[model samples]
Target: MMIKQVFAILAVFLLFVFPSASLKNLTYQETDKVALNVSASDPDKDAFSIRYGSPLDGNGQWQTAYGDAGVYRLNITVSDGDLSDSEEVRLIINRKEEPPMVTSLKPSTDALSVTEGRMLSFSIAATDLNKDAPRLCLVPGRPERFWGEGFFLRSRLR
Candidate 1:
């Protein structure tokens, strides 16, 4: 009876120690819609895995599919004699948005407009990647290096 109880406790410990519900395997085509590269890893080596929309469950072992363009779901499952479980992962396939273009740069050429009246001033244009408004920065020439480039960047000037 004591041995039986110890065996039961060991079984329960093993069952809980290793997370039974396998964290699903997934390969998103990049949520940004650029392209998709398959990446995956399994601790328990669950048999069922979906990579690039190719189901690898049969003797064929590996197959390839040109998954649809959009959010994709790769469902995963694990079974170990006593119990089984599953989970779904998300992958978004979208076009890669180009980085914003620096269309132009307008510098003051003269520092009279600046409070410092240092006679060295400038301005520029910047665009954001993904069309999500742009950000800018200017690094003024350090005092030691007065002969400098954009020490002050005026952001959100668009």
Candidate 2:
């Protein structure tokens, strides 16, 4: 009886102290799938998985598909897989794109202006969604690492 009691106490202690630690809630951005830039994050996550459910067409869960674009309910699940504690997040899949780019980059007529007692600030305007998002090289004749992105352009005045 004494041995059993001791074991029970240890078990209880472990259950309380080192319980199967895991994440609980996961969430998706509302702007996700709106511009087709769905992103997700989990607080105590260990792994990630995307399970595609039936679309408006009422088909089976789509784990993988191609060229299919519409309103689709996506069930994104993240799990520790050790404690069975996982989270599910819904995603509304929508694909967005711009027209083809067949033109070259245009040069800014405005030259670099450096002023004393003031910062040399300038704005850039571009049409490419990916390039103008501060990721691509914004400034002309500037280092690739020195570029800032904006909604319609990247603001890098160097």
Candidate 3:
């Protein structure tokens, strides 16, 4: 009789002592910092451990997401010593966008004497925070006459 009662209690424990875990997907920028709040519950109302990683070893924390730009799969596991459950989320880090910056511009000649067939040179220094390529062009005359390097008419400027 005691054995039968023990088996019944064991079956109840097996049916109701498992744990459940859940996580939320997140998005971030390369230079962004964030924190995560994890959720877990056990049917037995037992104290569980929260884990974030593959194999769910319960070791992870939110901090900064700098220099790491890509998609990352994160796993969270909740364990109650006897039973365990797991959840997963995707964290996407997008590249940051920044406008191009011009630091300095210097002319090759301090005094300009323009004549026919005379070539003028200018030194330009610029940088793009997003590491994007930048181009330089010289525009002359009226605003309507402004054109890019390939389309600019040197003869008109002369």
Best by TM-score: 3
Ranking, TM-score, top scorer first: 3, 1, 2
Residue-level lDDT tens digits of model 2 in 16-116? 12222222121222222211112334344445332223341222122223233333334323233432222232333333343333243333432344456
Task: Single out the weakest 10-residue window by summed lDDT for candidate 1.
Answer: 4-13
State which candidate, 2 or 3, has the greater TM-score.
3
Per-residue alpha-carbon lDDT of model 1 for 14-37, expressed as tens digits? 111222232332232322222222
- Superior by lDDT: candidate 1 or candidate 2: 1
lDDT of 3 by residue, 54-91 (tens): 31233343443334667678766667776666666666
For candidate 3, the TM-score is 0.45
Best of the two (1, 3) by lDDT: 3
Q: Where in model 3 is the C-alpha error above 4 Å?
A: 1-24, 54-61, 99-158
RMSD to true structure for each model, in Å: 14.1, 17.7, 11.9
Model 2 weakest 10-residue run by lDDT: 4-13
Candidate 1 stretches with Cα past 4 Å from truth are 1-91, 95-98, 107-121, 140-158
lDDT of 2: 0.30
Arrange candidates by lDDT, descending: 3, 1, 2
Model 3: residue 56 alpha-carbon error in angstroms: 12
Query: Which window of ten consecutive residues has the lowest lDDT sum in model 3?
Result: 5-14
The TM-scores, one per candidate, come to 0.27, 0.19, 0.45
Residue pairs that clash (backbone atoms under 3 angstroms), model 3 = 51-58
* Clash tally for model 1: 7
